[model samples]
Target: MRETPSTPAPRPIVGMVGAGQLARMGWQAAISLDIGLVCLGSAGDAAARAGAPLMEGSGRDGAALARLAAGSQVLTFEHELVDLAALGRLEAQGVVARPSAAVLSLAADKLRQRRTLDTLTGVEVPAFTPVTSIGELEEFAAAHGWPLVLKARSGGYDGRGVWICDDGRAAGQAFAEAAAAGLELYAEQAIDLAGEAAVLVARSPSGEVAVYPAVSTYQRDGMCRWVTLPASLPDGLDKKIGRLARTLAEETQLEGLMAVELFLTREGGLLVNELALRTHNTGHIHTEAAVTSQFEQHLRAVLDLPLGLTSPVVPAAAMVNIVGPADGSDPATRLAAALAVPGAHVHLYGKGARPGRKLGHVTVCAQTSEEALALAQEAADRLEGNG
Candidate 1:
């Protein structure tokens, strides 16, 4: 009798630093790839609730991070809230962390990113300066004009640490508040008119890279509400955007995913808004549109696996976030209705209801961008009890 050959074990048990919806989506991709995913978050986190392996703890806890890494082949990240310094310590102790501390610094520190991009040609950053006092704020406003933006140097997300000031008195007050929060602040010349967009790119340790099509993102209150494929950019802008994304991926020696947000001005110029060094919200539309989702691409990049195709398989697709309803009801209650929409793929995070919080998202694929976006919006509205 011939004995059956032994099955090879799955390589690269990934330890992700957060258990939010991003981790949950990554865990789903890991399942398809036959990989292990251990996320660091409480039992109540979306990934944890979905049965993803996890270490019960906070991302900021160094001890917890070590515990999570002890059993995994490589450590990665789902969000920027993790302690960067702790990651540096882990690297010193010989734990493998992809998009290393140095790479993380390039994206995690807002001011550093601005300064770094400022040196690169073909990339426009809004005029900015680190503001230390009210005097600095005034000086910047005088140079750049009123209605400038004040942003925290680091450690802020989802529009939490940004202020738009229209006058010296308001700018001074905003400066004082930032000082009281102990935040290092920077003042930026606000770009007026037009919309926003994001270009998602991924690079592997082996130097392989993938660039996805740029998408138009709609934002409200500085929080992204939806993203649509086939963005309405000017002639020749698509090629330019793709080239820029490729340059950043190759030049930075990026070993993970990066979503380069851009400010598309009415003047027809593109400005680099920010970079997210891991799987970003803007890529959620890829779940239904792209041949390979950003979650899987990021995993492949960090693990040095051959990267997957990043091409969009559908003609058009859009992702609409289901912000919590004012009535504070769970999307689960409206799931059946959302799923009834043709071509709508709904993903609900098992999270508690909270006003303005993103509880889930819906992605739709159709023959045109308008149809995809409209269907996605309808599904999301149904889920949020607005339809």
Candidate 2:
């Protein structure tokens, strides 16, 4: 057996690729443990404003990643968009990449995810067909019916890189555009469902698991607007969902956080839609509502430590995303107004404000789901200049 290097003289530092808000807030978590949270950020990135040791470069740069990897105990990522080839290079050079390249690769490509989900015996996924050309798309649509969703086999997220085709003509047009842009496309039947739900699960290196309450997401233009935890589903559905979530984490051999996005059909059944192998937008409410936040759980799992308790701190909680406008005033005033509400916790991701950009989130806790949702909505409204 190969001997590992001795622990650093004092606290261990963890290097994170992509210094977005995730890395910024992770810095807060690292502070409590006195661990250095190093970030590989582009020059002048918003997270650089947080004062962490920022390695200015692209995550795809092997030299940059190596520089960040040196002296770090573990390496992880804030965003999945990081170049997997670079991570594989790092792994070849003996750097530790939590969740492993094998697992992350499955989450990186939508086509691979769909195939893997299909291979799993008990997992239920939406009916999907891969389309590489206009003819295939037309045939799939004709067979499956119209008004289908066209999704890029890779890189689709938060409403970006997704399109809906109402007819064969629209599908052919989308195919032309996608082909011209060198994009891979897939077709899926657009089910008439109640809404979307997400369940967050974390697994330690030793296989211990913790599952958070399942939440329903409200989306507009494919961007999540709000998340309500402990979703009002039929009795025993929560437990079943929790079991399925754990099964995914274990099957993936995941070491850290994973969010399973699902479609909750009107018939009271859940179909897994996608998986995010990182801390997720829908799980942000766990920061204030759960006894152990998902961020901390991620840290613990990635470090190969024991799992934390995942019980809810309140009966119900809701999280609303703060999206900025094309023309808006400084966010400080709006943040202050939202903070004025009791039981409302605001987390601002320090980033340049762009139309439809996720600036931050407000999480609220209350005795019931409705009250918590109202509080979260008020906070979002205040942040969006509705005050």
Candidate 3:
């Protein structure tokens, strides 16, 4: 009888901090690669609910971070709200973290990112100033005009920690609130936006990079509502955006993925809006539309594996977010009805429903952008009881 060989042990685990929907998606990707994905997140996080291998801890806790690093060959983040100093300490101890703390720090601070982008050629960011008091805000507004945008330098997302001050009185009120909260603040000139778009790029430590096509995004009350893949832009504009994204990835020496948001001005120019250093909401459509999804690409990049093709398999794709309905009904309650929509690919985040909260999303791919958008919108509306 021939001797039987035992199966080899599984590949090294990739630890992710923050087990939200992004980490949950990463978990799914890891399964395909036959690797482990251990999430360091609160017990109640979406990934935990989805039965991911969870470490059950706060990302800010150094001990918890060390515990996660101990069990994994490499560490990456699902969110940028991590404790960078702690991550640095882990690096010193020889724990590998892709998009190292130095790179992640730039994304964690808005002011730092703004300053860095302002120095790069062909990059245009809004006129901004770090404001320490109401006087500084008034001065900025005086120079840049009224209706200025105020943002916390850190810890802001999904329409929170941002204020629009139309006058000195409003600026003063916003400044006072920020000061009370002990938040660093900055004032920016509000641009006349024709629309918004984003580019997702993945880079490996060996410097191999892949960039996805730019996608048009629609925002409602500062939260993304939908995205149309292969954004309809004038000839040559998409190439320019793709180049900018590649330049950013190379300049940052990025490992893993970066999503660059841009504001398309009414004057036909693009301005850098924000930077996200992990899987982003705008790239959700890629899961169903692209030849290789962003989540999988990110894992490959972080592991220094060959990057996958970034082209879309379909002609057009649209993704519509399922924000909780005003009545606060769960999307799960209507899951069957949503699934009934032809060609609809629904993804529920396993989050409790609350007004304006993101519960899930729907993506539809078709031969035309209009058809994809219509189908995705209908499916999302039906899930939210709006259809």
Which candidate achieves the best TM-score against the true structure? Answer: 3
Q: lDDT by residue for model 2 over 1-387, one digit each (tens)?
A: 999998867777788887887777777777776777788987566567777678887767778878888868888877777677877888898988887777888777888899998898779987898888777877887788978998888777897777888888888888888888889888998777887889999988888899998998888998999999788777898898999999999888888889999898888888998998888899898888898887777788888878788899889999999888767554556787888878889888877787788988999999998899998888788888875
List TM-scores for all candidates, in order. Answer: 0.96, 0.94, 0.98
lDDT of 2 at 9: 73
List ranges where model 3 is wrong by over 4 Å. Answer: 1-5
Write down the lDDT of every candidate, Cα atoms only.
0.89, 0.84, 0.92
Task: Show the lowest summed lDDT stretch of 10 residues, model 1.
Answer: 99-108
Residue pairs with clashing backbones, model 2: none
Query: Which pairs clash in the backbone of model 1?
Result: none
Q: In angstroms, how far off is 110's CA in candidate 1?
A: 0.7
Per-residue lDDT, model 1, residue 144, is 81
lDDT (Cα, tens digit) per residue for candidate 1, span 130-183:
988788888888888989999998888778888888888888888888899899
Ranked by TM-score, the better of candidates 1 and 2 is 1
| Model 1, C-alpha of 193: deviation from truth (Å) | 3.5
Candidate 2: list runs displaced more than 4 Å: 1-9
Quote the RMSD, in angstroms, for model 3. Answer: 1.3
Query: Residue-wise lDDT of candidate 3 within 1-387, one digit each (tens)?
Result: 998998988787899999999999899888899888999997789998999999989778889999999999899999888889999999998999988999999889999999999999989999999999778888888899988999999999987888988888888888888899999999999888888999999999999999999999999878999999879776788999999999999999999999999999888888999999999999999999998899999899999999999999999999999999999999889989989999999999999899999989999999998999999999999999998
Judge candidate 1 against the unseen true structure and give its global Cα lDDT, from 0 to 1: 0.89
